[model samples]
Target: MKYLSLLLFLVSITIAGQNDAIAKDYYNKGEFEKALHEYKKLYAQSSSNINYINQIVSTYQQLEQYDEAETFLLNILERINYPAFFVELGYNFQLKNEPEKANTYYNKALASIDVNPNHVFGIARLFQSHSLLEEAITAYNKAKALKPDFNFNLQMAQIYGEQGDLEKMFTSYIEFAVSSPIALNNVKRAINDFITEDSTNDNNIILRKILLKKLQEDPNLLWNKLLSWLFIQQKDFKKAFAQEKAIFNRESESLSGLEELALIALNDGQEDIALEIFTYLINTAQDIDTQLSAHHNILLLRTKLSNKEDFPNIKAQYNKIFEQYGKLPQTLDLQISYAHFLAFYDDKPEAAAQVLDHALDLPLNALQEAKVKLELGDILLLQEKFNKALIYFSQIQRNLKNSTISQEARFKVAKASYYKGDFKWAESQLNILKSSTSQLIANDALELKLLISDNKYEDSTQTALKLYAKADLLAFQNKKEESIIWLDKILKGHKTEPIVAQALYKQGQLFEEQSHYEGAITNYELIITNYRDGILVDDALFHLANIYIKQFNEPEKAKALLEQIIFNHADSIYFVDARKQYRALRGDAIK
Candidate 1:
């Protein structure tokens, strides 16, 4: 029996050694589940071993078993004076959504004399992960007090930055820079993030002050770069320009700083500053793309600052561009813009026409030709030469078949005819255009068509009551002008007509349309004087008040008219507007 017991003990020792080796191998490979199974068997046999207990806790944590991990850690804390065990317990409670229990354990861990720095860090990470930022910051500070290291400080600074606490972030970054000079990149990134996230101008100013102080203390390249950014954000272009110039002077070239400075000036409306920086880029930047961008921006800024009287200078700039790049396909855009400028600003429509005519003579493509023709038509329209305008518009219409430009040209043709008082031809054109594919063009065409159709019907009033039915149709169509015109003809040709009062009231509306305020007032007075019992008397009085208030701008006259309408025509349809206007003119503050 003794010999058998010795052999079993030797076999058991060999198995335990093999299990330890397997557990270490799995732990090193990060196969935590396999490592846990091996460690669990060893821990079951040797429960008092602190390393075994720790491995079990770690495996439970790896598996996200918060309750198991917390129970194992509490058991270790009860037997051994392991300060870090309390922190692990705190983390487990936090993972279980028990913040109060986590806080209790964290305070206990912090009170220990032999506390591990990792424990403090764990507590900080737990609070930060749970979004308890203020508490996290306090824990992070405690961790830093225990171990003043780069990793802990960086984590604390990042947490403060996430909370948008600029002051704390800046302080931490500055301390980091002073301790580890190689971490200047980190400092720059932190400051940039703080400035970008800050919305208020005052906050920006505060950040600038902090950065400038850092620059004054640390005369490093990173500090200078940060100063340049600060100046750009504050729109102090002169300072930014000087800083970038100093940097490039010391180094060979720094196109990035110059590009950023130019963009900043452009955004702040500092044209001269932008021009200065762009000129520097054109002269010094070796890249063709950078030089081209600089030249383009300089020209754009100059164009924006030039006025109409500076057309000669503007023309000279375009001429220089065409002289240099006339053979290139891209010059066409410049030609188009220059032509438009000559037509509108220089008041040189003939010159504009000649420019476009020359473009047409070139080997132009279809789209280019269509654009030029549209511009030529616009110039003619502005010159008030309707016949000439129609010629260009018609060309675009024929060339750009079934396109939006064709629809636009048809609308312009109708507009030109209407301007020339050719109502019949204009109405025909508008009727066709009313069905255009473009909604805006169709709406305008429909409105003009209605105007012409109603006007002709109203003008065909030979007899007094002959077109009464037509006038009613006009009213229904909201053709206020034609309805009033036919009504006026009736009042003059058939004064004894039964609809005389209605006609007189409509005549008041026509006078109002023509902005003849006194004429409208006189017609309304006729309605009140001659047809007091007429149903339109109340309407006439109400419209008279509107004419006085709106057309004539006579507040007192409007006030009296409204009061009269309210007193004599209380049941009129215009009672609402009249009462509102009356109260407003009386200074009653009507909304």
Candidate 2:
């Protein structure tokens, strides 16, 4: 008997829901008479359902029966204490051109809020729905005045924003964020629409002024953090770093925020501020990990900016760090970084491999040991010991099956095979890795696979491909100059070949590595002009645009080039970055 009753309740609910959908469908299709008939039946079955009441009134109005809507609202208002019904009645009378009656009903809705302040929400939403902005604002203000505990700042902020009053909007949003810190990120997302990449934009200046005034008055860390975020959005890394510093001093808390700020500045090419932040971390960080990370990045930045003339000095800096820290287990990552510097920067792969060999002797976990072996394999590959590198990579793959690091090792195995001209095994490995869990590894595998497959048919002997692989291997060995020369040979010998575009891109990268900006631009421009339909066209365009921005100080040209990728090559891997840079260059207000 209980089961039968439950089943009957469910069946009735399904029938009612279907009836509701049918009424809504009829109303949407402009069959208002039919909609009104169905709504009346539903309202008769459930007289307490406010939704059915509202729909019946709306269907009456839709069918030009405003008097009927007024009658129904009046009859229902006594049974339901819905202040919003007064607004709806006012709307119905106004639709019938009874202005004085409409005003009376609107005033009645506003007055109902005083009797119960919670009625303000429904009344204000109804007023706003009818485009009655002033009435809505007045209702919210009246409720707030009557009840001191009411917080309508978020609603007020949206209204003020819609009204083009940014000052009030920003102030209300700030107040809302302060009152409910949990919604702080949501508030930031809301306000970010008005902010742009331009630091000197008037909206940005206004937001800054507001944030700064709050900072002066309250001395709250949230204000400073918001100020920092605002500065970051404006690309004002120096000011952002200062705010981060103030927050750090006040909280004396974790260095994670400061670390993130440093990386942000670094990524945006604010190298000096990043270096300062890193130096500060290295000096103030209490933990060994933070200090090691700071030291690691500082050395990396210095090496990247250094020429061969500065190589020995960078090595001495590394040695000084080791002398101070004594190559302990905590310093294992630093050791691996140092090995990479030695191999890739200092022309000492053999010495780099020896460092990792010593590191392998240390007692480490599987992940730590795998990390060391991965770098070791890369170094061995740089030294042309492809089989030896594969030994390490294969071990990592076997031990950590299906892990991200294992997939990375698998990718490396394929790459090493490609560099050694073992195309068949490399192709097999790449085909498997095309669906890797790591997108970066999968992308790399697919590109290498395409490069091998595209050129394999053009030459029966694979002579040109072998030379290209040799050039690639040379570049991996940090022999950028030799790599460029070999790529030139491929360009000369295989001028009509499909691999020419790849050769040009590789040579352009080598040129950029050597700071030969014009040579890089020339090669990249060639690819853009001749290979507009090719896979590397987006890459060429992006790289060329970057050179224009970073090297030539010609953002207009960069903007134009990036626009091509935005409109033409939307599927390209560089499309997102191109759109972002393009928008920044164009000073787009949209975030």
Best by TM-score: 2
For each candidate, the alpha-carbon lDDT, in order, equals 0.71, 0.90
| Candidate 2 minimal-lDDT segment of 10 residues | 582-591
| Cα misplacement distance, residue 25 of candidate 1 (Å) | 45
Worst 10 residues of 1 by lDDT: 193-202
Q: What lDDT does candidate 1 reach at residue 572? A: 79
TM-score of model number 1? 0.42
Model 2 scores a TM of 0.90
lDDT of 2 by residue, 1-591 (tens): 999999999999999999999999999999998998999999988998978988898888878888788878888988888988999999998998998998999999999998999999889998887888788899999999999899999999888887778888899999999999999999999998887777866778788899999888889999999999998887788888888889889898788888998889888888888999999999999998999999998888888788889988988988999998877788898899899999998888889989998988888899999999999999889878889999999999999999999999998998898888889999999999999989999888999999999998898889899999999989888788999999999999989999999999999999998889999999999999999889889999999999999888999999999999999998987997798788778876541
Total clashing pairs for each candidate = 0, 0
lDDT of 1 by residue, 1-591 (tens): 999999999999899889989998998898989999999999888877767776777777778887778777877778877665666677788778898998888777666523666656545654576576776677666766777662555777788778877676767776677667788776776665445322244446666677678778866555566667667655578878988887887776558888878987897678888889999998898876676667667666676566667767877877886675572435556666777777766778899899888888888887778778877877776676779989988888888876877888887777666655566787888888878888888877885675556444444442443354346445533355777777767777767655566666666776775567787888898987898887677777777776776667788877877787788888876886687567656654111
